[model samples]
Target: MSTTPTSTLRFCLRQWSAWAPGLETREAWSGWDGTLPHGDASPKVDAMPAMLRRRADRLGKMTLETLYAPDIAYHGQPLIHASRHGEATRTVPLLQALARDGAVSPQAFSMAVHNATAGLFTIATRTHAPVTAIAAGPETALAGLLEACSQLADGAASVLLCFSDEPLPALYQPYADTAEAPFALTLDLVAGDDFTLGTGAACTEDATPLSLLHFLLGGETALPLSIRGGWQIVRSAM
Candidate 1:
């Protein structure tokens, strides 16, 4: 039998912020009592300065809002931003510009890239600490969590993990495997005794990030998620 990596995540999930269509995420998340709603999420990032807010697309705005979510001001460095499709909103426009004039605007090109939000977050907060940006198709969240756990194991005090995504650009809409409505969630994790995380090879219907979100926000005792190669990401409260 092929074996997969397994370890106890051993982290205190201090706080989280999530937003989705027609869902007052703050209120619902405060209690973990609401279902994932359907429809376009109302995009609003009140914490960001107006100018910088305007510069970012929907995904960027969500990531920043979740990063700056109330009361997470003291979290340690090394923010992890995970997504299946990164900066897709601006991808089409950039491709169009390339097709038309063989040149793309420096400013648009910068914001449309995958690392744009993480880069902007550092500049906006003036925190030089490291930030990781990851894009791994449907396995994005699983991979991101593994990386974050590894970092914490390496002695980092805490990590801010944000999984955010929006619909693929219209030009590539048919390839989407996630919900039509965009979703963003951030977790402030620090190695502790409050939680235990484990993973193995299995299958499930729920998406990885969503499965984790529901478990944490819902206070479930166990969670199982599907991954490529028949692997499973499992969790339980300690």
Candidate 2:
């Protein structure tokens, strides 16, 4: 086998919030220590008005909840929304409609795209900062982090990155390969003069973005993150 070199991107985690089945509050999550939760997501998106709430499905609501978690100050910063399978829950039904030679609903089709939720977020929050939607198979979270870090290093004060995904529909489960459940993790990141960010090559199988998220929630200042390209990314304490 050919050996591939490792690379890393770094930044400081300013704030974060996550919503999984069993892990709801920061206190409850911190007590669990790296345990992955199962089931549907019921994020606290109550800040959103009732009209806007009806437009978003379970996943979108969870994404917005984490993205706007009280810990995240949401001050018109750039945003990166990453998902392994975006809007698949909504699109699968549309596909079945087309398969049956049935007319597709315009509203459903509009919300079926990958960036649709991001658009809704910008509109709901009334923030004009740049928003990027990303889907990179298994490497989505790392790709989103790199994008945010690049923005920070290039001079932006802060960046917001949110990673969310839902379980694939039963009809599509055979083709879907993802470890994600109905979950959303948001991080408000900043690059500063202090030495708060670093990266390195990784060999461990558990060094993924979601895994690192659990570690970080457990009050870890340093974490090992791995992507699909066989690279490890690490963050060190100040």
Show where candidate 1 strays beyond 4 Å.
Answer: 1-8, 30-36, 74-76, 229-238
Displacement of the residue 139 alpha carbon in candidate 2, Å: 0.8
The candidate that achieves the highest lDDT relative to the unseen native structure: 2
Candidate 2 stretches with Cα past 4 Å from truth are 1-8, 193-207, 218-224, 227-229
Residues 1-238 of candidate 1: C-alpha lDDT, one tens digit per residue: 3233264556677777777665555776666544555665557777777877888877887778777778565434788888878888888988999999999999889898778888887887777888888988777766787778878889998888888887777789887666655777888888876665465545555356756787777655555544454444334424
Clash pairs detected, candidate 1: 200-232, 201-231
Over the stretch 1-238, how does candidate 2's per-residue lDDT look in tens digits?
2222244345777788887788787777567666556876476588886777778888898888887678889878898899888888888889889989778999999888888878888888887879898987766766777788788889988998899888888887888654557788888888853223334444455354567576655554444445344554433434
Backbone clashes under 3 angstroms, per model? 2, 1
TM-score, structure 1 vs. true: 0.86
The count of backbone overlaps in candidate 1 is: 2
